[model samples]
Target: MIVSSFFPGRIRLRNEVFKDAEIYAALYAAVGNHPAVKKIERNERTGSVLLEYIPEKLPINKLLALQSDLLALGKLAEFYSAKNKPEILKKIKEIESKL
Candidate 1:
């Protein structure tokens, strides 16, 4: 995943492809509700996520960590199988707890 500052209050995440639309949908469901996030725009063609957020409400460090964790989850999804579903879900829960 590639993460960079896009604007004063925006961040761009690039190259985040998943195995399929289902995994992509799951990723959004997991991270789209961050309290500090003002808006989220996903580019399906390029597998990128653009985030606009309130710095005061959510520190940059926290946002970065959250995005990093989400990216990791997405990568894991690429190799998802019935045997690993439970482990993946547990990890997702762990990441969510931090948020």
Candidate 2:
């Protein structure tokens, strides 16, 4: 039951469980014989876990703009303080006018 990966010296663990068709048959037989993990007789098929809410993809341009805005805010915060609110507001207004 050797499973090869692109990266060297890596063998997937599942290969040991389902190595070949013969192993799969043996596993099914063993599980069927065991009372603990007995086969279910369901009419409907079950599905894997899935995501309920999917988010919209953000554009690269918008992402870059957000990053730039964050950097500017960080720079402004470093300069501005509670005691110097008036000066900070004046500077921000001056910058806003330029923009």
Candidate 3:
């Protein structure tokens, strides 16, 4: 994730994973529901997310970490699904090929 822009109470971030709408939506939902956040917007086309929040209530890093963890947990869940075992191997090979 890259902090495209940031100031006092607002921040914009861009991540390649966010180009996948489903992943972006998941993060959007998770962060948008937070009490400290006033607004959240995402543009999947550009993989950009903007957040308006109460800086006093929660540090921005914690919000970013929360989104990252949620995304990881969601992906990890897919790996453990019995129906996805075959898919897990396929994905592993895909990663190995990159290495």
* Superposition error at 45 for model 1 (Å): 1.0
TM-score rank, highest first? 1, 3, 2
Off by over 4 Å in 2: 1-57, 83-99
Give per-residue CA lDDT, model 1, range 49-75, as digits (tens).
787878888776775777766677657
Model 3, span 1-99: residue lDDT tens:
567788767988776555655555555555666677899888878877888988877775665655644344436444454465444334434332322
Candidate achieving the largest TM-score: 1
Q: Which candidate is the best by lDDT?
A: 1
* Model 2 per-residue lDDT tens digits across residues 6-95: 122111222222323332343344323433322312111221111111113323343355454434533544554456444434443433
Compared with the true structure, the alpha-carbon lDDT of candidate 1 equals 0.67
**What TM-score should be assigned to candidate 1?**
0.61
Q: Give all candidates' CA lDDT scores.
A: 0.67, 0.32, 0.61
Q: Give the 10-residue window scoring lowest on summed lDDT in candidate 1.
A: 15-24
